[model samples]
Target: MDLGFGREKRLLTPQQFKAVFDSATHKVSSKHVLLLARDNQLEHPRLGLVIGKKSVKLAVERNRIKRQIRESFRHNQSILTGVDCVIVARRGIADLSNIELRQQFDKMWKRLARQRLAADQANSTGQTNA
Candidate 1:
């Protein structure tokens, strides 16, 4: 698969970030991460990372978390289509290894994808019945 974390696959502006936070329809939380997801009109998935200094403390640690998150998202882009996701780093997340972080993110991404598929099916069925 083509795994490239391009600018188009990132939530860049304040308005875009606010839209995801304000209208999130799915959320998945793990020990050190909380993923908030919203359905978007686009054909591909986009990601936003919120590794605040208040939570992570050091810039090096925060950058590591962001890199891991982005890498995981890049590899799972196909399954995450049509969704905008924001990953918020919780306190103590900096201690987790990259493997553990990827595993948690993978689980949450699958759950979010399933939720989106179910919602789409329900909408399609309702439209057909009407």
Candidate 2:
């Protein structure tokens, strides 16, 4: 229940971000966002955001979108454990309000959790079959 957006919960290095992008096992996408996730072999989830200037245009708007994404991730971190997630902002994301963004993020997080569960089950079942 520690819901703080700590430094440990952020994808800080270029190599870390590249690893998630290059080897993501799960992806969730909407009109305004693309969420790519890979297992990080850690106890907590980490977030990396890519809000390109070409898509968002203004620095203020991009910063606002990042804030919304970080807040949403922080609130849902418990359920998002053991994954490194990268959220790429698409063109229309800047137009949405914080509430709408949060809603979208919530859905994406649920989808990711489901995928993780299914993958775990598959692994367990495969081991049993062997």
The local distance difference test score of model 2 is 0.93
Candidate 1, pairs of clashing residues: none
Using all chains and alpha carbons, the TM-scores for the candidates as numbered come to 0.92, 0.97
Question: What is the Å distance of residue 51 in model 1 from its true position?
Answer: 0.5
The C-alpha lDDT values of all candidates are 0.89, 0.93
The true-versus-predicted C-alpha distance at residue 30 of model 2, in Å, is: 0.9
Off by over 4 Å in 1: none
lDDT of 1 at 114: 88
Query: How far off is residue 108 in model 1, in Å?
Result: 1.2
- The residue-by-residue lDDT of candidate 1 on 16-117, one tens digit each, is 999989989888888788889998888889999999998999899898889888888998899998889999889999889889888888888888888888
Query: Candidate 2 on 8-109: residue-level lDDT in tens?
Result: 999999999999999999999999999999999899999999999989999999999999889889889989999999999999898999899989998899
Which candidate leads in TM-score? 2
